[model samples]
Target: MTMVSDLFNSREIALGVWLMIAIIAVLFGKSTRSGFGGVLKALFVWNLMSWLAGMAVYISAFIYLFYRIGLWTPDLLKDTVFYILFSATVSMFKANKISEDKHFFLEMLKDNLKAGILLEFLIGQYTFDLWVELLIVPAAVLLAGMQAFAANDAKYAAVNKLINSIWFISGGFVIYHVVDSVIQHFHELLSLGVLRQILLVPNLTLVFIPFLYVLSLRMVYEEQFIMLSFKLRDKKLLRFSKRQAILKFNTDLRGLKRWVNRWNLSHPQTREEILVTIDAFKTQQYLEKAPPVVLPQQGWSPYVAKDWLPDEKLKPAFYDPAYEEKWSARSGNLKLDKDWSGNGITYSVTGTRLAADHLELRLAAYESKKLDELHAIFKERVALLYKNATGVEAPLKLTNAISRKKNIHFRQGIYFISLEKSIWGNITEGYDLIFTISTKND
Candidate 1:
């Protein structure tokens, strides 16, 4: 009876719960078949940093609270001071090392530290509340692990589904415990001798609401992928351009095989149609858009290239002034024009559409070594415009530099930006930019 009582004590139960969670993370919470070795390494390193930081924060809080309440004896004060110094020393050293390296593992330490501090503070401040220490801490740790795995894109579809399943189940458990905790705390304060059963509507509503919202978003992504896959299977993809369709539908061979096999099983006559569709997609030859294998010779000129075109002949694109003229002449009131500053830089803008869509712009910089700096300035301008337009407090704006490809795609506001580096290796020849406005209806 004494052993059982000791085993179920708050601290012991908390430790046991965390141990079980760590085991689960190593065994089933893995995102990839690459194995748990890397994840475990990251988890241990981050968790140790977290533990030290949390210890420093919580120990300081404990010392402050005890001293203020006139509960601090010399032994308690000495132990607190010792822990604070030790934790601070270890934390500072680890933080400095992480700053110096700046790897993903180091980046994850901040998240782990935040979670650990919150859990440890709750546990240390409310030491008698075994539910907070044992139940809440484990749930928080598992949620953080699953979130990190998904956020980092270290994903397998099966693992993702399993993680969400666990999320739903754990959410239910958390709701139950929270209600029990609230009831117990209420009884302690009110001195209630006995309690009747309580309604769970409020607890369930508060805890499970966010889970339902996120699950809806997950379902939306799955539906999108499924619809795209079906279109590829059916050979009826009108809405997406060839390039857009390819980018959206492309997957690894194993993934593609799984998709195809399942699709074939459901629609038996789709075998021939799917093969034909895939072959058609493969024959489209998107490889021609890739950058050159070897860098062109220093003196080589695109204008003097052996086989393509005469210097006078320009490719037909949104860049051609004549093509711009024809497009602008149409009924919906669109105009495309270029602004050339005297300094070898040009900015192109397409006229606004009535529906308020994403507009694409083409920019060219010639005979300049500050191409990167120029693009950075343009991206910053675009980010500001997006912020003002949307009225979002904190918007994520990023630019991806392309070296081995001709086209890049991303969205800011309604504007879908596609940057094409047609003559990138030799910037003397200049590059092209294209922006398309995605309409509200689309």
Candidate 2:
């Protein structure tokens, strides 16, 4: 019974529970199985690298400092605190992308907090210089609560925030006291003056707390994004050339910076690292002289339609009005016509022989807002149909890139596409897509 009681309250038990939560969250959370696997792989790599580098730095720094002071005795408290800074710095230099998915991000938060808690407990067993609970508990609660707020996760936000407030207040009361106590003890041991000890010890540990907080919250999560992207690449789902991948990496870096800036705007250490990623991306060679996007209009030509169906006249077609019903009436300034204006445009064969069949489709939107909506609907529907019927790629890139001409057009084997914009003194606007298809069965 005594053993059972002790086992339940142990720090090892706490760490195990925390790890189990992280694993469950990642596996059943907002990601696919493959994505969760990638996230775990990335976290392991990040932690492994950080641990190795931190141990090396800790050993070298410890040996040099002891030798300089002629003190051969090891100071576990100071050593553990100092080592955290080195480990966290290594993580910063090798930054990773953060995910847009909230589940993956939450899993990373729990995993990192668990790691910190385990570290605090392991180090605490050696030295009772500081209260481990005061440091790790508040840090974990604060990170988890802040993440909930950032993600707008309603289920846990209110409860987390309330509990975090108590822990934060309690932790605040002990932070400086604990650091000072640890510093004072070391000062007496080395016979260092008050001023020197104050400068040497508290500054590093004091600075380390905020770093550890942010690191536990974000860095591990960011690395998972890179792994996710690599997994997509491996599956042939995302096809990108080497140059495109670099460009995409730069974009992800910017996105991660934006996410960090939103949650922890005032963290100077994080801000500096974010700035470094931005500068590095902007200086890339491919992006330096990229051409500005253009949408040009090409005049219509009476080209023979492929596999043309023999029809007496071009058929009338109208744009779907249901797509704009939601936002079309939101602003009173814009008004949509109550009827399909099939007579807005007309087309017919011109030559005497009328040797080739020709067809044209035209649509119109009266309200400026509806014009944008119309464009989106037309593009998506047409792309869908094209993909379904022919098993070919949609022409979205070509459509978006064309210059804004009066009759911008393009033709594939048997289909031609174009759009017309309606403007009335710049106050009212409308647009339509003209698509022609052959009905030949042969």
Candidate 3:
């Protein structure tokens, strides 16, 4: 009981409170995922040891520098150390890109120097009250959240400008405060005025660490998003469902665009290159999966005339292979005169060999009251053939035609279909459809 009581006593309670506050700041500022569950995952599932080691290195370096500069009293040193630890903890979460690289210790040392940790430590010397130091995390979080919110939408553009102004003014203030504090603390022993002038540019440059940290987070998120997209693309392609694959690609691409748009609004320097990369990926995927130009030769024909009609009711020309062979041999434009007639309807068929492994066929129906019936039958047959060839449902639908264009255009696997209606002079004449299918390229 005594041991347990000792753990929860005054100093321990204060330490626990500071730890809780530090965790909250990390949850808001550094976590890439969302929600309380996401926090748990980030805390427990991620590389916790790496994060701790990185934070420890950064805090130790800052403390050593501050100690060398005589910036800490023995009593004040404990609080200063805690405050530095809190700041470093919030900044260090998910900093694996720098901290876990090859030359990890050297990289961490470089990061501490490059990220203005010493300047922040100097500022902390003057702002050592626990309450004042506590406010720093909340202030940083608010500013970061506001900046992110502003980036997310144009409606918050005014807010974004205001935030930029705040960052500028706050950076200037930080520089002034550090310069003045140094002058006040070491006036007798050093030419602090000359030192201040010498340090001005570097201090000004480093004061924008908050903004830089946000940008770093965005870069990390972009890398993770890209890797995930590649995995998703591979997984969806392996499933071999054209409709699902295209749908999922479009959905994910839209999300990526929105994310990039926010990032572009926040940081426009890389917008053009980023958009170019995205467009290139889109074009590459489209070209890789695009339907073949030539139609497949297997299980394909322009025999809607013969197949749809009962054999007993068919004309003799329907039974002749030479009839189709003659049309197949003729490469130029189709002629209406070379057509088959049956049951008050006329069918004109044309076949063109586009490649060794593929064929293109056109089937036209004329003087037929059963145009709708013929179209439905033909569409069903084509769809079934497509399903058998691709092992997936045909992504085909009836679309409205415009200005003599095809009413339906669909592609699945290596097959393409263009189904259209031929209209003329207030007469519902017929249907003209083209089919192209090609064997999978080796």
TM-scores of the candidates are 0.26, 0.26, 0.28
Give the winner by lDDT: 3
TM-score of 1: 0.26
Tens digits of per-residue lDDT, candidate 2, 80-104, equal 4444555445434433322333354
State the C-alpha lDDT per candidate. Answer: 0.40, 0.40, 0.45
TM-score, candidate 2, is 0.26
Which parts of model 1 have CA positions greater than 4 angstroms off?
A: 1-65, 68-147, 150-162, 185-442
**Candidate 3 global TM-score:** 0.28
- Model with the higher TM-score, candidate 1 or 2: 1
Across residues 81-190, which tens digit of lDDT does each residue of candidate 1 receive? 43345433443334423312325243443433444443343333234456666766766677778766765444555676777888899766655664566566754534
| lDDT for predicted candidate 1 compared with the true structure | 0.40
Alpha-carbon RMSD of each model: 24.7, 20.5, 22.9
TM-score winner among the candidates? 3
Error of 2 at 313 (Å): 52
- Model 1 / residue 299 / CA error / Å: 34
Please identify which of the two predictions, 1 or 3, would achieve the higher lDDT against the true structure: 3
Residue lDDT tens for model 3, 1-442:
4664333333334445677976686678645325666757777754565545644565456446645675433434444444445544554543434312335334444654565755654664444334544565567669999898777676889999999998899878768966787788765336543344234323322432443354344445455455444433454432332233234444343334333333322332233444454554455345324423534543233333223223221211221112322332212332223223321222223332222233333445554553445445445545554454446766625323312236555555555545544444335454456544444321
